[model samples]
Target chain A: MSEALSHRDRCAIAGIGATEFSKDSGRSELTLAAQACRAALQDAGLTVADVDGVVSCDYDLVSYGAIADALGIADLTYWGQTGPGGSGPCAMVGQAVAAILSGQATTVLVYRALNGRSGRRYGLGAPDPDARVGGRGAYEEFFAPYGLVTPGQFFALLAQRHMSTYGTRYEALAEIALACREAANRNPAAQMHERALTLEQCLAARPISLPLRLFDFCLETDGACAVVVTSAERAADCAQPPVLVRAVAQSTGPRVQPGVMYPMLMRPDITVTPSQTVARTLFSRAGLGPSEVDVAQIYDCFTITVLLQLEDYGFCAKGEGGAFTESGALRPGGALPINTAGGNLSEGYVHGMNHVLEGVRQIRGTSTSQVTGAEVSLVTSAPPPGTSALLLVRG
Target chain B: MSGMFNDVAVLPLMPVEDDHDTGGFFAAARRGELALRFCSECGQLLHLPRQVCFACGGARSEWRAVPGRGRVHAWTTVTHQVHPAFPTPYTVVLVDLEEIDARLVGSLPGEAELEVGQPVRVRFDRAPDGTTVPNWEVEA
Candidate 1:
């Protein structure tokens, strides 16, 4: 396929906006969504009236039409919802790009809002019993009975395997958490702002699951984030400098089924993951490599996830992430400054939406803890069964 | 299988449907056995068994019996209990079956003794209903 078909002639993120990271927004999810949407439009020098398309994750209770109606945007030409939690941000951006390229709409607004901290907590356990009764409940039914109910428990198992197989240490994982905390200390909007964590502190934190301390997991927060995507041509007319969407791709691995391990074991390698497929495809399409990335906003739902993604994205050789991260490679002055906005670990988890906003800020040179001279950014999401990568460049 | 606890309220009993067929999950107890359905036309083993085959968009499907022998693909010991239904410090396992291309999840009777890739056989326990719910026992 031509560059235009593969990467060019697609949508660009014209503006990005977010609510201040908080443990609790003390407001409804709908209100949070509207605030972020309005802020994004203001940043783009556009109005809510300019957005003709909307896309979001499937789990969001708020519907596309509801957002459009609340934002007072007239007739939406395109609207879509993608699955899996953390992957939504990247997938929604891709959907918006596709919508723009296909002429379905000229301006697409993608947003995510969650009261994950104060409201219903996903980490608590399996889906509600009502959800398990129907066909949709099949996957949960298989695991819930066996007590593999929460994401933390499920990922902890993977962490144990990584530790047992590669001798990865809990202290090394704590270092990753510390780096994120130190970075967030410089970010005024980070939920854990100015709260520096020491290895001792992390070690003292209560254990949520074996091999995963409370600090190792992302924070539950009530927040919202939104981004605007429009044609590159339209972006030129906008007020702020645009962040070109150089490439965007999504992929699924051999075992697409959630909570199943057959495909994972059948694969030739346990360390190498399908997220690499997304990264490889994205780099090839964007004509960039790991060295060229000035900054990265990797999804850090869990520290192990960040480590796994580092390997899968070829930032380091497989199983080398523990050591790579331990060497301070992710620090601001380091080779690849990851999660400069503190990431899900310290920045509060908005379903990885804030990471996308941080990417836009890095290119704009407006981040609170900006990576100086940064021109290119890599944003990745490792939703179970697959990964999504997006290459964004400063315009 | 004979000594397996059938009256444990903690254990959940449900049916397994062929990925291709969704008429209803075949009734299985904690130790019961049933085959996954497949599309006769497409030969595709269905999961989350539905009324119609997702492959080839066909509707015809039939279940075939197979020995419930498998190996552990992955397992986790949950040390904390977030839900009231489950007791803390239990083990959950994903087992890859030999006769079918699918994998299933169940309690790891004794996870400390079980290793990854260890052989196991399905042992069905009688449920409140006449059907059985499938659980696993390490092969002798």
Candidate 2:
């Protein structure tokens, strides 16, 4: 827990890029990866020859070498990937920072490209036993046979507990859904940009699982989003304003094993997620606190994911998320405007990569729903088997 | 099971026969009993059976049968069907097996009014795949 030798502000994100978000990209994952990588390099005033490192999520269909090859990057010095999906975006940036500070590579490309809606959708439920490889490990035997398949179903049990424990209401969830949709309405890049959601519409949405409705789930979208990372010194010479990486941390609570994908059954208390640990480590390393965060891009894979993280990340006291969100804290003019790019909820589900892009945008003063004078932005990965978070400050 | 909902037959994905970790649990279920793996060295009970003891790093574990009754910790009624095999509208419950210090998830195939902390007992049902798996019935 030595915080004195922190890597805060050692690296910066100098470029950001993405392709059109839609239900079907109509392109191969590799093409999407190459398109986003080229755009990111061009954004940073760099080129394929400038990039020596590559990083992505393990669930990404395209391999790191394939991306570098597609973009004409030769002689890569470093490449890596983080796993289990959802909890990857911020960690990917963290990987880039570690690589840069350690001299494994000079310039790194962090990207995520997938046609999630049209290909291998996560919410479609469990894969056939024969179809699954090594990661799950006796997982389906315990839950799938009983009809507990999708991530949404597991979160429903958690949300139900939180509701029973804290009196959290569905209307509070509606508040979160409405806020993101309102933000999306202002951002043309958002899939839900043209569509505005009302409290009434959110509240009345049909149930996918109890205590969680259709709107509660994030959009299953097809898209690719990426960012370019380099040494803070090098970033200053790039094209766009550098968003300094203040701190990043990833953690998993004790006893969160065995049920790798969804460990709800083993957890003593399902209300708290791994974000609690990540928050403590992230802020401690950054030499800052939650009160200093001007805006956030908390992952919204599900509305409950947002609610639990609100408490776990210390945005509010435990069990106070419902009332806190109801107070409009997550809205545009509220205390902390989150998911300003509409997030995974409305913008697109490029996993949480879009959240990272939005965080960088807020720092660069380029966000469509930009928070006025926002200097410090927080971006968190999904709250699950494990979680990660990052702090970006205006450089 | 008189009031159970059976209109939609569910043929859920069954366990792989050679899965070393979960094979014993399924074998016990076929015999109309609920069993879980316990660390032979440290006595830590584990569900979704594990190869080693997480509590003490014990390398050996063994299967033990326990009472099938427990209280519902939390639950959800899934209205949307994510798989073709499982039709819409099924209630899944997480039961806290306080007696064995373990937890398990099973579906309520019949109509039952369920709530947190309500008593539930496990019942064995044969899947369409010809494998016996544990489901739940609310105890009146």
By lDDT, the best candidate is 2
lDDT per residue (tens digit) for residues A1-395 in model 1: 44446755356899888887677789988889989998999999999778899999877867898899899987888999876678778888999999888889999999999899888787886445333321343344445555566777767767776776677888878877887888789888899996878999999987777768888898888899999999998998898998899888887765454433222433434555677788878888888888899999989888888888888888888778888888889887987888888899998899888989998899889987788988888888754656677888876
Task: Indicate the residue-level lDDT of A89 in model 1.
Answer: 85
Name the regions of candidate 1 deviating beyond 4 angstroms: A1-4, A129-134, A258-273, B1-5, B10-31, B34-71, B97-102, B109-114, B118-121, B137-140
What is the DockQ for all candidates, taken in turn? 0.35, 0.51
Native-contact recovery for every candidate? 0.36, 0.62
Give candidate 2 misplaced runs (Cα > 4 Å). Answer: A1-5, A129-138, B1-11, B110-112, B127-130
Judged by DockQ cut-offs, the docking class of candidate 2 is medium
Q: How far is candidate 1 from the true structure (C-alpha RMSD, Å)?
A: 3.6
Query: Considering only N, C-alpha and C atoms within 3 Å, which residue pairs clash in candidate 2?
Result: B4-B110, B4-B111, B5-B110, B5-B111
